[model samples]
Target: MSRIAELTSLLMPHLMLAPIGLPMLTAALLLTMKEEQQRLKLGLNILSTLLGLLVAVALLLWSHESGAPATMGVYLPGNWPAPFGIVLVLDRLSAMMLLLTGFVALCSIVFAGARWHRAGVHYHTLFQLQLMGLGGAFLTGDLFNLFVFFEILLAASYGLLLHGAGRTRVQAGLHYIAINLAASSLFLIGASMLYGITGTLNMADLAQAIPQVSAADRGLLHSAAAILATAFLIKAAVWPLNFWLVPAYSAATAPVGALFALMTKVGIYTLLRLWTLMFSSEAGPSSLFGSLWLIGGGMVTMAFGAIGMMASQRLTHLAGHAAVLSSGTLLAAAGFGQNALTAGLLYYLPSSTLAVSALFLLADLIDRWRNDGASLAPYELDDVAPFLTPELMPTTGLNLDEDEEVLVGRVIPAAAAFLGLAYMACTLVIAGLPPLSGFIGKFAMLTALVNPLGLGSSAGTQPGLPGWTLIALMIATGLLALLALTRSGIRHFWAAHDRPTPQLRVMEGLPIAILLGACVALTLQANGVMRFTEATANGLHAPGTYVRAVMTAAPIPGPTTTPTPERAESSATTKAAP
Candidate 1:
């Protein structure tokens, strides 16, 4: 009976994730029912999202109550032990990610209904499936399972992207398809390489096993890591590979664009999850891989995104560049791979996603603009109506140009304001500005990076701060990006003279509020959030926690299905605490 209870407790978290999967499955079933089942689909969408959110909340509560990571299980095709079969694990990270996925989906769905027509086939169904994929990716502890989720999402996104009939959309979707398919292929190849090397697919098991592998084989593992990173980087839109972003992001409808924000973050999340555990190289009494490759690469990616953003002319393209900017900034921070890097990454997940997502809705208004600014000149509201109205403007009006007619009908201008705020928030946070979380993360990473740790740790006058040239350049690049973004922000807001504008809707404004609110929340709770992120980063740096969690019931011969451990001691000397 006690065993049964333990098993039940273990299974509960997986049970929580089931709602996400069931909805997707049901969506597939509903597809064959009829074209008139839109209502059913709608109800399912709402029901599934609500249920998922509820489960996420439960898992979070349960995790807190138990004072440990949640565990769950569901055997496939006759009960079989994990190594030969598959299982899911729901750690704190998984639970947090699930909640975020549900939240974003719910908001996007609500906004979608208000705007887009129900003319399409099973629009809600595809959405549910997309949620299913996202939730699956977060919940699954198994690498193969992660791949399954990836395919699920990639397929769903392809369908969603191609929905409706526009020649440009079709063209864009095809391009999106081609690029993503290539990424998927590389992802598959990398997974295959990893499996061949390690012989197991469980992330936890692999984490334990990787550090044990011989140094000679490190080459293969690094190669695999590089390939995997490449796939995700493309998805994340790292420069030199981001040509598809401007066109794809610009072509999508507002709702589509909003949903797309979470898409690339998936890659960033994966990088943090997998690479940190499996590939880091540290030295000395506490060797860990805070990741030194960051300095040059990150700076370059940041510069590229900044250039793209500043150069963009149209609203759509500008939004696209903003997305690019997001990847570059976050990826650069992530590459630093320290306590601060984790903080920035945590802050980034919501900040940039919110900014870019809302910016799209704002841009949509501007894209269709044709109102003569001469019309609404008399009213202080009219000049700012396009952005201030219920549709485009968010609840926060603390930063608008009052009395001046400059903000009228131009969706781009309003979007520009939102972008500016979002950028300033992100830049401040990322560039490590004082009184902001970004500054804290940057400072921490610089501590780790230049040390004989080589990136941040320097001799004399600093225990944490390193005097590496790369670190200096990163600081410099961040300052430069900050200046450029802020200057552009001033132009977008202050440069505008009064002009006539149109009204906005409640639906449109919600995204902006949600996004900006996220920024505010991150700022307000930086200390607490950083504490949690410290916990997360500790788990990331110390593979044992991850390994132990995944390998809980492994056999004596040890993790029969896990990939062989590689570079085991490289991270052994590192000190990590959440």
Candidate 2:
């Protein structure tokens, strides 16, 4: 082979590992660095993120070109068979998630470089570890490994959430940690139950074994699945189970909050992956299991989110609830089980995630400006409204050399105008207003809900009351969001007392622009994106492809069975099956 061709061939098999491995290695190196080496840390962080983004993009493109779910890369570490060893599978869904994670992390890290990273020790290390955990979770091919990755990311997140120690953040972090620990325990119990029942921790093996589960044990399996789903739902910020999300997210510093926009989606992503693969139409009695629960829980979550959004006065709280809204919407759509609805949801997911992240960062900047002007003097009982003033400026200790610049005559208006316009763009995207990718996503969902068949096909059956309810909820949620954001925008930008325009650096502002720019690109390429998602949805409906790919690609011991001779023979036959 030619040298270039040989080199490509040599490295091609390991491409799937690059995204997960690079961040982990970077994080380990970062842990050894002194906190004072800001420049070195920042440079390494950016370089690592840039490389990860490139790898994720390459994986996405490769998966798109692969043309079949079975062809998507499945990397088994140590060259062991899939069910017997850890595997990293990269289908369109995983690849897309990887890309989104990389893109969002890149933007958040870059934005943080302007200030947030310096807020605490080992921020960059924790950030990279977070990426590693997310990537691993997305790519893993088994439930046991999923739990492992979840713990890794949650540990990193606990640190990141408390990065800048303060009363609010510390308190919120404690609650967040406590809740997730409980969830983790539930996760362990559920995984153990599943292993006890099916004798497999590999997701693909579980899919194969679940169908064969006896009627007598199906209820137990269902209970185990419920336990697992509950854990995921809590992480997804579903109603009642998600009380910790808003306070924790709102208390987090801006960049961490922005990166966290993807965390809830990770829960949604796991639900979609496991449910479709193991409990879809082909899973016999377990087919479409718990779907009603998904739909009902999702609707209630949306209702809660809408009410919260309307009531929220703070921007961070609004962003947190908006994320909840997105999660609820996706879960409901996933419950519908129609490929068309899922396709629309696939398009909607990334668009909404990007918008929420942008909103988090933007809200922080605006809040800084608004709160900076508050009175800093100690309260006196004799003074009226003694509790309403800020005891200290929001930027009390931060270096503000950039903000200290005095803009001459016309420059102030121009700067203010830029920030206002950016804020408006984010508002439009979040509220699903005209002409942006968010609108396209919601419009697609609505169209899919009305016509569970592909758009423009009259033969498609009309949806029932549930669909209509979802449609109404979607519309009402958007209206509520628009009103809430519009009111907040007016008060902050127009009615509030004029303060120094938030000092935004190029580094800080560029990340927002890039994210918004991605949204615009999604709008421009809506047709192509939708087409890809349609294919993805179809792949999701066909669980056999995923299972067969994992099982047949490498020989592994068959799922555990009874120790009787007949059962042993049966297991051998299954393991020997082509």
Candidate 3:
């Protein structure tokens, strides 16, 4: 046992880098193989993704077990000191994100193996590269490398978006590429400006420098931060800057869409990390910089997303809008800067992401099922049944048993039942209804917003106007989403009489089930998950701890030897003679 413990400790640092390196190496190896060997490639891709998931789980457990001020594992790739070397900081936040990325990637790759992998030339390679980029982005401790990983992921996403190569995909892919290219340029400019102002790109170093920045350059610093935030906001699909998200995400393949769900959260994660670190109460004049902008913009984004959802007719478009809604909620919660609210948002993030991804996958199956039958013509509002009157109802046939006794209920096909249940779960979760993880998360956030302090505290005060406004918006959006999803569900499952049951492959169905099953697990373990998120939030709010951990981390010592006695004596004698 002692030997195993020693071995594990020695190898843990290297394991910190495996999430990024393993996928990259796998992608490179995949390039050498022919496309004809797809089964081999598929197996390799799944194995790599599973390994990444395991590594992520291990890291999460390590971070959790290490306890607070939150143990941050800092790995210097070049064996150089902080602010000078490539550093990867694994904290609770980064570990959680890494785990989410691995799980989503694994599910997506498995789903793609059903057919989408064969849709393009280097699908598996690009998918692996996408995972590599996401892992790097989460683990990197510097702004420049964040940009590098951003480009890496976006470049890979360009190909994944156009996997099927249809006209719609080509159009959406072109727009996605153009917008991201522009955002990348902005990222570079903002990073360069910050580097010039602070003389360092490491996040910890930046945190240490933000408070000491000269008054003269403070405005420039704020400007640089805003410019950088604009880039992330665009990626996060926060309204106005998010015109392209619906079309782009709606057009991508199902598996690609599921993975793309995490891409938006990357931007959210960056904002959360930077805001809590650089603009905390300790940052003098820059304390909570841009809080109003985040709150106000997030509210507007939520409104836009709600309206978009209510108006959307296609399942894919509805799912895209739902993603936007989820992003908006997170952004607003982040703006509040309350520890409890932050914890709630952390819990909400994964629940909403999983629900949205499941919806995306389910949308493809439902659409295919619809396509398998006769197409229905569009109907006007008046044409939709205002209410099902007895006179208007059809009395065509009754489902009866062989004995002519009336059956209590109709027997639904297994595939159709699965689709309906999955869709229902997605709807309930996204709508933040009761008895699911989503409701628990939203309830926590609402409680925090209303109290802004712990319950039963004597000094508790009412939520201010902004808080009330956010609360109102959240409720309204939930109602709107419920209506929208219910309508879509009826059309897809209940109203359509001619559509055939979808032939769902195990590869396809299993991923959706796994994702939904995760939501169920979260619901069952809500208390434990909330505890973890609260600890993560507490660590994030205390920026000084993070700064100390990163800046004080020592590099691995290079090989060295003790001087021999004879050699030391001869050197001493020579020095004395001189």
Q: Return the top candidate by lDDT.
A: 3
In model 3, how large is the Cα lDDT of residue 541?
82
Is candidate 2 or 3 superior in lDDT?
Answer: 3
For model 1, the local distance difference test gives 0.60
Cα displacement (Å) at residue 569, model 3: 12
| Candidate 3 structure quality by residue, lDDT tens digits, 1-578 | 99998998778878999988999999999999997787689999999999999999999998887566577788889888889999999899999999999998899888777556665678889999999999999999999899999989999999888876656777888999999989998898899999999999999999889999999999999999999999999998887999999999988888999999998999999999998888887787788899888888889999999999999999989999999999999998888778888889999999999999999999877876776621111112133224222222222211122331221223335988898999999998999999888999999989999887663211112358989999999999999999999999998899988555666667778899999999999999999998899889888888787888788888878787786999899889999994
Off by over 4 Å in 3: 373-413, 455-463, 562-578
Q: Write the per-residue lDDT of candidate 1 for residues 354-449, one digit (tens) a residue.
A: 656666665554333323322111123333343222232324321223431232222333543453465455446434476554455556555555
Q: State each model's CA lDDT, in order.
A: 0.60, 0.83, 0.85
Candidate 2: tens digits of C-alpha lDDT, residues 148-226: 8999999999999987676677788999999999999999999999999999999989999999999999999999999
Candidate 3 residue 51 Cα shift, in angstroms, is 0.6
Ten consecutive residues with minimal summed lDDT in candidate 3? 373-382
The reply for model 1, stretches above 4 Å from the true place, is 1-11, 29-40, 64-79, 117-119, 214-216, 280-290, 369-501, 554-578
